[model samples]
Every structure is written in C-alpha cells, then in structure tokens.
Target: MTWTFEEMDRMFHPRVVAVVGDKKDRDYMWLRSVSTLKGKVYSVQVNPEEAANIVAMGFPNYSSLLDIPEPVDYVIVAVPRHVAPRVLEDAIRKGVNGVMFFTAGFAETGEPEGIRLQQVLTDMARKARMKIVGPNCMGLFNPRWGLRHSPEQYYDDGGPVGFISQSGTHATFFSLVGYQHGVKISKSASMGNGIILHADDYLDYLGQDPQTQVIAMYLEGVPNARRLFHLMQEIGQRKPIVVWKGGQTSEGARAVQSHTASLAASTALWQAAVRQANALWADSFDETLDLVKALCFLKEPVGPRLGLVAMTGGQSVVITDAFAKAGLQVPLLTPRSYQELATFYSTIGGSYRNPMDMTPTSRNLDMVRRVLDILARDDNIDAICYEFNMGFSAREGMVERLVDLLGEFREAYPRPFLCVLSAVHREAEAVGVRQALAQRGVPAYPSFQRAGNAFRKVWDYYRERRERGATRPAPAPAGPVRPG
Candidate 1:
C-alpha cells in the first residue's frame, strides 16, 4: 500500500485501537493485550454474549468496525480465518490506518484455500491502500504508548532498541527476556507471513525513527533479499543493526516454510550478505540480546585490546582465554601502565599483568579503584572487564560499594567498562547485583564468556563504523535504557 513513515508512526502510536472477535473463548486475549494502551480501545464482536462480556470489561463493544464512532487507527483481527475477509472489508470501509491480522490459517498452512485467502486479503488491502501487519503474526509492540502484542509485555518503560521479528513467539520472547536483561525496546513488530508489508518496510521505518538508536532483527527470511540488504547497508551506517537469522540449517529451513511460508536462504549466503552490509549477525536469542545490550550500553570501543580484572588467578586465565577466543586481544599493558601498577600492587596470591588477578587485594576497594584507574588510562586497552563472584561479594558486604565504584569509573572513563558477575551458588543474588550495576550504566553479564562475546560484537560494530567513516558521537552516559 506504500505507507508513509508518518502513517506507520501513527499506526504504531494509535489513538484508537479495535479488536475483532475477542471473546471469552480465548479469554479476550487480544483485548487484554491492548488494555494498557494509552488510547481508546473498542471490541468488535457480533456475538451478544461476547459483547456483554467486553462491556463488563469496560471497553465499549461495537457490532462492526464501521459501527465504531471514533476513527480507528489500528485494528487487531482475531476472527476465524473464514470470517477474516468480512472483517477486512469492514476495516477498509472504516478507513482504519492499519490492521494487524492475528488470525492464523493463512499461507503458512500450505493449503490452497489458505494460500488463496491470503492472496485475496493481500489484493484487497493493496487495492484499498491499507496497511496490514500480519495475517499470521503478532503485530506491533510500542512500549512507549503501551501498545503491546501480549499482556505480559512491559509497558511505559521504553528504551532505544527497535526489534523486528518474523516469528510471533520470538518477538514476544525477545521483549520479555530482553527487558529482564536491560534491553528494553522502543518498538517491535512480529511480521508473520509478511504478505502486504515486507521486513524491509519495518526496517526503513525504524531506521528513521528518532526514538530508536539500535535496531535488532530476527528474520526467518526476507522476500526481497536485495531490498533488505540495501536497507541494512544504508540504515546500519547510521544505527547498528544486529540480525539473528533463523532457518540456518536444513531442518530449520523446512520448519521456516511451514512456520512463516518463508524462503530460507543458505547460511553461507546470509552470513556473507550480512558481513558485506556491515550488519552484525547473532546466532541465537541470547546472542541477539547480548549484542543489543552491548550496543545500547557500552561506548564505542575503538580497538579489540581488552583489559581484564578477575578476583582469582583461575578466573583471570579463564576470562583471558574466553576473550582471546572471541577474537579480542588480551595484550600486555603498556610499560607505563605496568610501572604505575608496580607502586602498591602486592604480589601476594595475585598478579597484575593483563588480567589483573586481584585475589586477596580485591577486598580492598581502594586497590580495585586504583587498578581500574590504571586500566582506563592505558592506551593498550580499549575496553575493560571486571569479574567477581556475586556470592562472595555479598558475603563480604562489598556489593553496594563495588557497584558504586564501578559506577564512578563508568562515568569518569570513556572506555567501555563491563562486569561479569558469576552466580557461584547464589543466582538470585547475582541477578540483583546485575540489576544494580545496570541501573548505574554498567553492563553486567552472568558469565565471563557472555561478557567477552558481547563486548567483541560491540567492538566489531564500532570498528566497522569507524572504517566506513559513519561513526556518530558517543552516546551520553546514562542509566539503564528503561525510562524511570
């Protein structure tokens, strides 16, 4: 339908939303999902029982989209597949800006009827110049406006990340899991069986979205590979785009067709395309969030040289190996940095080389602060990683103090500083500490491997950005991206 950016924006930030066929049978799922939306919500149900129930829920009930008094900005169609055409006709007649077809049984079903129905709706929407999100997908999630695809999704705590996924489950999971890990989203779309609107359309819109600073994508496949790749190259130059392509394997590709009717590309071809476009690639959900967290929280790391701080000698060796294996350098600190460390750096059960083993001395906050200061000033190091066992830190009553110290270092230093909080039989305590660190603008991972991997992705992104002369000014230091 060739929707304008403004039109898409309004659809995302709708003033009025309508849900069709939200009945007690499904527990009024679609209606409840949009309950937190900061706009008028109407239920379109022809059934008298469902209408009365929707009224009891407080949202006004209407027989059809045309019966609604207000102009519907967005419509969620949850009617049966056979009834979808009628709803779409009504929606088009009502002049709705967008309709997200949450109803399944479309082309993904692989039946002729299903495919024909999909084409029918596609033609209708295009003829009427209507914007449709998905006939088999989860639609838009705008946290800022509390427009959500699921009731469980967070609201009113928007961040700088914009996510696009083909699978509805992946979209919902990304928002749910990403939020707990400090990767709150600005806007996200689950574009299932993207018939009328392609993934490139969402990418183009998000690329220009002022609220979005980093874009994350979960793609089963792209219908127009060339256009998608071009958008990646153009948009990625401005904002980092992290892509996690599903259907990389033969089995996954077979599943992708049935799941979204998508044509999965060869893994080699997809990887090469992503690298050529200078877009980051992630292998799984965790990696996607990890990369996003790093991109959102960390400053632009100028080099691969990483300075490591571990509480124990074994940890130092392990983390060093982790980072090095992740394609990051654990080079020796400059002579000047070593000379400064020699001043009060005791050699008792600790070493102050690259991965400064702060075993016994780590208990002393002053010594930890000094070590961080030394690393921050060292030219050989572009990023810093500090590892601590959360269980021990809490027992020593140093969690709060360490978080504050790290917060200070984060603010004072331009280098990207991260913390790896090992659970060590205290997983709950580790989560609290990680949250605290996140609140103070420090990216904390559960393990050394995660910390190193996330940092390496950020490093690769910045390095590519620099090489392309597309580097933007460093983001201002801030707490977690979530709004207070």
Candidate 2:
C-alpha cells in the first residue's frame, strides 16, 4: 500500500488521536504518553474497568473506534496480537489516516502464530490502503504538535532534526538525551517490524518536511535496499542525512532478526553504499547526535585547517592531537598572523603558535578576543576551536562574557567557531554553559574528541555538498536564536 505524502503528513499531525487497549494494569501507559497531545484524545477499551479508569483520568472512553463521536485521524493500537486485526479493520472502516500497532507479538517473535497474525494484519491494512506504522514498534513523536511516544519527550519546542529508529528504546532515548546536549527534534519515529510502512517511507516523508533540516536514522535494515539508496542519493543532495546502521557484526545481525525481523546487509557494502549516495555514516548513538548537532549549528562547509586555543599549554598539545587524529589539520599560522600575534602576545607564560596557549592570561577577555580576531582574519585558518574549563569560567564570573565573545565571533566571522568545555569534574556547570552557548547559536561539546570528530563530519558533509555543485551556504542554524 503506497501512501501519499499528504496522507502521511496528516497522520503525523493529527487533530484527534485515539489509544486502543490502554488498561489500568499497564497504568494506561499509552494514554499517559499521548495525554499531553495538543489535540483531542480518546481511549478505546473493551474492558469496562479500564474504560472507567481512563475516564477517571479525564479522557473520554469508547468501546470501539466506531463509537468515537468524531473522525479519528490517528489510532494507537495496544491490544494483544490476536486482537490487532480487529482494530485495524475498525480503523479502516472508520477511514482513519493511520494506526500505530504498539502490540509487539508480531513476526519478530519467530513463532508460527506471531508470523500468521502479522500477515493477517498486513493483508487487511494493505487491502484497505490504511497506513500502519508498526506491528511491534513504538510510534511517532511530533513535538511541535505535542504528539509523543514517551511522556518524557519535550514539547512546545522543536528543532531541525527528524530522527527515524527501528528500536523504540533508541528513538525514545535519543530525543531525551539529545535534549540535554541541545539537539532537539522536529519529529521522530520508532518503527519496529515495519510490517506495513518501511524505513524508506519515513525517510522520504522527512525529506520533504520543511520543519526538518537534517534527517538522522537508526536502522537495523531496510526492506528495499535499492529504493532506500536511490532515495538517499536524491534527498541527500538537498538536506543532509546521517545514517547509523545497526546489526553490523555477525552476532548483532542475528539479534536484529529477532528484534525487528530485519535482514541485515553486509557492513562493508552498507558503508560504501552510504558514501556513494552522499549520506554521512555514524557508528554509535553519540556520534549520530554529535553529527546532528554539528550539522544543526554549523552553517558552512569548513576547511580541514583549524586554529586551536586552549586554556593551558598541555591542553594545546592534546587538542591538536585529537583533531589531527580525526583527520583535521592544525597547521602553523600564516607569517602575517604570527607577526600580528607576536606584537601583543605575552611569551612569558604562553606561545602564539598554531594552538595558542594562554597559560595565565586567558582571564583577560581583551587578549582572548584579540587572538580569536587574528585567527578569524588568517587566510590559512578555516575554523577555530577554543577550550576552557567550565568550572573556572563559572567561578570567575566569566561564562556569560565568554559566551558573548564567542557569539560575537560566530556572527562576525564566516568561519566555523566551536567551543570545547572541559567538564572533568564540572559536568553540571558544562551543561548550563552549553545551553547558554546554544541559545546564542554557538555549538559546544564536552570533550575535544567529540568536538573534533563532529566538526570533521560536518566538514565532510559540506565539502561533498560543494563538490556536487550545490554551493549555496547552508541555511542559517535551524533552531532558536537569542533575542537581542
């Protein structure tokens, strides 16, 4: 059953959503998850006890989807496997836009009954041309519309990333953890089993979504490799798509079969195909979010040459090595840059070479600004990375000033400016500082490795973009900007 983009759009942004089979025994989990939805919500339960409890929780209860007074745009099915077909039938009869089968005893279980039940549901939905998200998955999350699969997801705020994951756990946690690091979601889906709607379906939908600037995927496998790769090649030319393939190893491949009933492809082939399609590849959850964050905040394709700044001498060496290991260059500054630095640089406790180390003089905002200014003007420097101790910055009452300075440089200079906050014992302080910088449209990371690696991915993405002749500067960082 091929669904049109407009039909899928309605499913994502529903005006009225219904939760089927939410019972008191499970604490009405599905009901609670969607209770915060901005649109009207109703509960469909045959059990009188559960229906009464749902009503007590302040939601209308219906014995069947047909019993609902108004048209239902979306339905969340949480009934047992045997009852899933009945719910889908009712949903099709009601002519709803879509249904998410939260019930999990589908083909992934590898049981004869599970397989048969899944086929039955699939056939019925396909025959009716009704879109089903998953037979063994968590559903969708649209923060802008207050639609969510977990109660913990943030609403009333949205960003440029649209994430698609085969694992419900990854989908839920990605949004939760991403919020901590300033990577918010415009929409996300956890499509387990994907019996009716496949990963490529969601990818194509997100590609056309104007709200999403960067699309990230956590996939074990896709049903149609050719279609997926073809779509990636086309969509990636416009918006960046970062893919993190799961089940890469032999053991993981076997696990993927039971997890989502997906047929894992060869790792080598997957990686090569991803690059050929002009999409970025990530190894882990952290790398995916880091790449997304970098893509979200950095606006242009940067050169591999980076100008490094560190609070201490030792850090300068460590930062350089980290970036160098990540395939980035930390070459010496141009002759004119070094000459300009020598005029005011204090050689007493610092060296003004590539990674300028301000031993005890970093506290002077004027000198710090001057050094950054010189790097910004240096033709050889394509980007700048500054490292500081978050604990000291907060204690010295310099967090706001430093953020303002970086923000100013970010705006005044076209080169990418990044910040690395040393949060060894100061993780709590780093969080606040990161948020402050993010509010000002500056990206900050907790470690040199992550800062370097993420920036490299961003650089690679834009460099490829430029190589393909799509040379327009990336759209201004897609999230909120601090008010002047």
Candidate 3:
C-alpha cells in the first residue's frame, strides 16, 4: 500500500487494538502495552483459563478475535512463529488494518522453515492489504498516543524528533538518552526485519509529520535503494535527517545478514546516497545524539568561522586543532580589533589575536563578559566556544559566575555559543554546571572534538539549506523507478 502522513496517522493512532497470543504471567501486556495505549484494548488468549485471569487483573480478554464485538484496527502478535499464520488469518477474517509482531523466530533465526513461514505471513498480509511492522520488532512508540515498549519508560507528551531504528534497543536508547539530555522526542520505532514496512515509509510519514521537525534513523539496510535516496532528498529539503547506517564493513555486512536476513549495501553506495540527499551521516551513536542536540538546541549559524575562549593557553591549541579538522575555520582577527581588545588588558603578557585568551590575567566576571561581548560583535566570528572549568571550594564563586555569564551571553547574542568543559566535566561541580547550562538551552561538551563536531554539523546543515534556497526542489523521476 502507498504511504502518506495521513495514512501513518490512521495506522499508528488506531482506535482499537488486539493483543493475540498466549498471556504471560502478571499480564505483561496489561502493564506494559495495554496500560500505555490511549484507546480501547482487548487481548485474545486461546486458553480460557488464562483469559479469565487476564480479565481479572486489568485488561479485557477475549477467547478469540471472532468473539469480540468491536472491530480491531491493530494487532500485536506475540505467539510463536508456528502459530503466527493462523493469527494473521484470524486478523484478516476480522478485517484488521495493521499488525506488529512482538514474536521472533522468523527470518532472523537463519532457518529455511522460518523463512518459509515469514513468506507465508507476507503473502497473507499482501492479499489483505494490511501494514505489518515486524515479525521480531517492538512496533511503534509514540508519546502523543502513549505507546511504548516498557511500562517504566517515560514518554514526552510531544517532542520534536521522530526516530526509527532497525533495533528495538536503539529506539529505547534514544528515549532514555533524550530524557536525561533534554532532547525532546515525538516518535521512536523499531521496524525489525523491515519485511512489510520499509524505513523509507517512515521517512515519508515523518517528512510531513507536523509535530516532527527533525528525523533520525538507525538503518541496517534498505530493500529499495533508489526509493530511499529519492525519499531522503525529498525530506531533506523540508526537514533535516541524521542517519547512522550500519554494516559499512565486510564484517559488519556479515553481521547484518544474520541479524536481519537482509543484504548489506556497499559502503560507497550508502555514502553516495547520503551525500546526494544532502543528509547528515554519523559515525557513532554518540555522534548521532550529538547531531540531535545540535539540531534541537542551537540556531542556524551564519558562518563557519569560530571564536574560541579557553581556561588555559595549552587547551587553546587542542581546541583550535579540533575545530580545524572538523571543517571549521579559526580565522585571524583584524589588527584594529586586536588593538581594541588590548585596551582591556596589558599587551605585555596578554594575547588578543584570536580565540581571545582570558587565562593569563586575573578574571573578574564583568571583564570576561566584555571580552566575549567584543568578540561576539566581530564579523569574523560566526560562532563562539568558551572553555569553563569550575571549582566550588569558595573559589571566588566560579560556578555561579560562569553560569550567570552563560545565561547573559545566551540572552545578548544571536550566534551559537558553545561551552567547552575539557576534562573537567567529570568533576561534580562541573556536572552541576553542565546540567544548568543545558536546562537554559545551552550546549556543553565534555571535550574539544565533540564540541567542534557538533558545531560543524550544525553549520553544514544551515549552509546547505541556505544554498538550496528557501524551498527544496522535488527530484525528477528516474526511468522506471518511481516512489511507491
């Protein structure tokens, strides 16, 4: 079936749901799945005795789908693979719209019989024209609808990010990480095996999803390469996409086959696709979250030139190298601006060329503020990175001063300001300061490389967006390949 934003809305936000399988002890579905659903939910257990206990605990249980009085919009199949086909048959007879398989032992098992059973389920689903999420997946997790994987997990009422991953853990990973780091999320889904619904389908859905402005994905492989590339190009023009494509190496590719029973596209082709779509590619999971923070926290930077302030002169060298390698510029200040900066201090030991050093002289909070204020006004500087290391041993109230200064800079300046914590972020005082800054929507990095990389991604996105003009042009169709 064709995919669209409205179709996604109707399918994911279903009115009625059925959990078809053997009931687990303590009613796991009632606590984790059914309790979270914001719609009418009923479970179909084959054993009448277990069904009685399930209904007694909390959720309404049924002996079979045929006995239920209301129509089922979605089904979560948790039975064994051998029993799944019959459940699908029952669902089709009952006119179910979608199914998410919480059961494994299908294609991922690397057995011929499992593959055949998966094919049977796929054929039945095709004839019925129903969307299937996974034969080994956790399905959809949406905060607006209160859909989640774990009962203890917290869902942000309405976040700004829509995430889809091949692994269920990655979906849960983002939610846990986002909750602690202040990264708001709208949707997190694990489309396991991706047999029926592909990753590109979610891209189309998220591209027009009004609640989501940024899309993040963790992909192992795509069945239709051309479709994925075109869809990414279409979505990239409207919203930014941060993708972490797995199986880029020979070893990783072998692992991919066993993991999902899908072919791993060559790294060269995958990178080309990412470049063609003008989407951001991440090397590590931390970097993936880094891109999310950059997109969510900082505004678009005007240029790539960065102004660095440090706690020590030695740290300046490290910060400068990191910035340069990350595709950012550390430009030399004009002689006039240099001389104006020298007015704040003596020219003997103080250096004012660029990355205005505040470590040499004794720093009062006001003087440091003026120095940053001066650098922020310069046309040569598009973004500012300040290094702060604090001690709470009555060290002249360093933590408070730095926190206050950061707040003021955030209020006064329009450019993106970064806090470089170096190795000091591990300190107890620094951790407190970091959280404070993050709460104010200010980004604080533990090291120079991370800080530089985050800013570079932010710059590249805005620059590309600017060059492409205000609107992204739709791509022309290529031969016989067209978006389904």
Alpha-carbon runs more than 4 Å astray in model 3: 22-30, 46-57, 335-353, 356-368, 388-408, 421-439, 470-484
- Give one digit per residue, the lDDT tens place, for model 3 in 440-476: 6677777889989989987887778778774632311
Off by over 4 Å in 1: 395-397, 473-484
TM-score for all predictions?
0.95, 0.96, 0.86
Model 3 clash pairs are: none
Which ranges in model 2 have alpha carbons more than 4 Å from their true place?
471-473, 476-484
| True-structure lDDT of candidate 3 | 0.75
lDDT of 2 by residue, 382-476 (tens): 99988866655654668789888888888898878888888788776676677777766678887899999999988987888788876352453
> Compared to the true structure, candidate 1 yields what TM-score?
0.95
Worst ten in a row by lDDT for model 1:
475-484
Clashes of each: 0, 0, 0
Please report, in order, the local distance difference test score of every candidate based on alpha carbons: 0.87, 0.86, 0.75
What lDDT score goes with residue 113 in model 2?
96
**RMSD in Å for all candidates:** 2.0, 2.3, 6.4
